[model samples]
Target: MELQLALDLVNISEAKEVVAEVAEFIDIVEIGTPVVINEGLHAVKAIKEAFPHLRVLADLKIMDAGGYEVMKASEAGADIITVLGVSDDSTIKGAVAEALKQGKQVMVDMINVKDIEGRAREIDAFGVDYICVHSGYDHQAEGKNSFEELAAIKRVVKNAKTAVAGGIKLETLPEVIQANPDLVIVGGGITGQSDKKAAAAQMQQWVKQA
Candidate 1:
């Protein structure tokens, strides 16, 4: 399993500061949807330029023109780009094909999809790198999570690795680890902490031990 640090609320400089503290503990640095919205793909370019070793994931949550978006993010030095699971199969295929040509990856975010398992099976057929079960900030506000959805995707997604994200914290990392997701994503769980380094260190340790 790998641990990904999501930089949603931070700007490029703040994102760098946080990564500098916990870079050793994380395998991937995520330029979250919010960060991308705020700083554009320049955020991805900046982070990747700063930490060349750490993989950078651009959370585009793309719904259309997948090929073009993936190409743009890849050009920005994004190792992986995201597409919405609710998007059409043609979009998913375009993204995957573009990613393959660019030697990058596509992670399909199943944030609002209703039938996760079914959709995961279909997406897996397209050879996506990862199928992520995610609960956006709005759903998290209503007290929703994607733990069960993670399990559902794990059951039928044979071609793609599985990932889980949404409000994951040090206190809840153990449960997520037990689910055995291929990748574990956390945003406020670590970024919102008083001691970001310590929080990231502990979560990294736990993910490694698992």
Candidate 2:
């Protein structure tokens, strides 16, 4: 499993400073929704330029103009781009194909998705590289994630690679990985801490054990 440290709702300089230390430990560095919305794609460029060795993902939560959004993110140097799983087949296909053409990977976010099994099948069939099992900030605070659901999603989409986001602390990493997600995205767990390198190292060790 790989660890992805999430920098969400944080200022760019602060996020970058944190990333400078943690980048060596984590497999991927994620620019989360609020961070992207607030800092724009500039954050993606800054992080890419700052940490050339680390992988960067831009969480655009793209819902429209799939091709354009992917292109914009790619121009900003995002190694991976994300689009909504709830989008129509054309949108999903468009985004995936564009990312492929640009040599960038696409991750489909399954947030607020109803009929998740059916949606998983659709996204997997559409050739999404990953299907993220997400609990948005509010849902996580409400205690929404269950290991049963995590395991079930992995089972439901046998073809698509899986990832989990929201409220992923070091304590929860092992249990979450029992479902076998390829990656773990954590926001507050690492970025919110005073010692980011230590936080990232802890999560990295936890993922290795998982």
Candidate 3:
């Protein structure tokens, strides 16, 4: 398993400072959708340039023009880009094809997909690098989580690696690790803590042990 820190609510400079504290412990640094929307792919470029050792994921949550978007993000130094699971198969295929050409990766985000297991299986066949089970902020606000969804995907997904995200804190991480996701994404869990470095170190240790 790998630890991916999601820099959602931060600007470019803040993102850099946060990653600096936990970069050594993290395998990937996600320039989240909000950050990308606010700061543009320049956020991806700046973060990747600053932390050359860590894999940088641009959360485009791409819904259209998959090939062109992936190409643009890859050019901006994104190692991985996200496309919505609910997008058309052709769009997903386009994203994966472009990612392959660029030698990068595409993670299909199953955020609001109603048929996660069915769609995950379908997307898995499309050769996406990772199939992520995610809960957006709104759903999380309604007390929903991706744990059950993660398990559902784990049971059905064959080809693609699996990932889980949203509201994953230290107290809840062990449960997530037990599910054995390929990647575990945490946002406010670390960023909201008073000691970001210590929080990240502890989370990384748990993930390593699992």
Candidate 3 pairs with clashing backbones: none
**Stretches of model 2 off by over 4 angstroms after superposition:** none
- Which stretch of 10 consecutive residues in model 3 shows the poorest summed lDDT? 201-210
TM-score of each: 0.99, 0.95, 0.99
Q: In lDDT terms, how accurate is model 3?
A: 0.96
lDDT per residue as tens, model 1, 1-210: 899999999999999999999999899999999999999999999999999999999999999999999999999999999999999999999999999999999999998999888899999999999999998999999999898998899899998999999999888889999999999999999899999899999998988988
- Of 1 and 2, the candidate ahead on lDDT is 1
Better of 1 and 2 by TM-score: 1
Residues 32-108 of candidate 3: C-alpha lDDT, one tens digit per residue: 99999999999999999999999999999999999999999999999999999999999999999999999999999
Report every candidate's CA lDDT: 0.95, 0.84, 0.96
Among residues 3 or more apart in sequence or in different chains, the pairs in candidate 1 whose N, CA or C atoms overlap within 3 Å are none
- What does the lDDT read for residue 161 in candidate 1? 93
lDDT of 3 at 103: 99
Least well predicted 10-residue stretch by lDDT in candidate 2? 145-154
Candidate 3's TM-score reads: 0.99
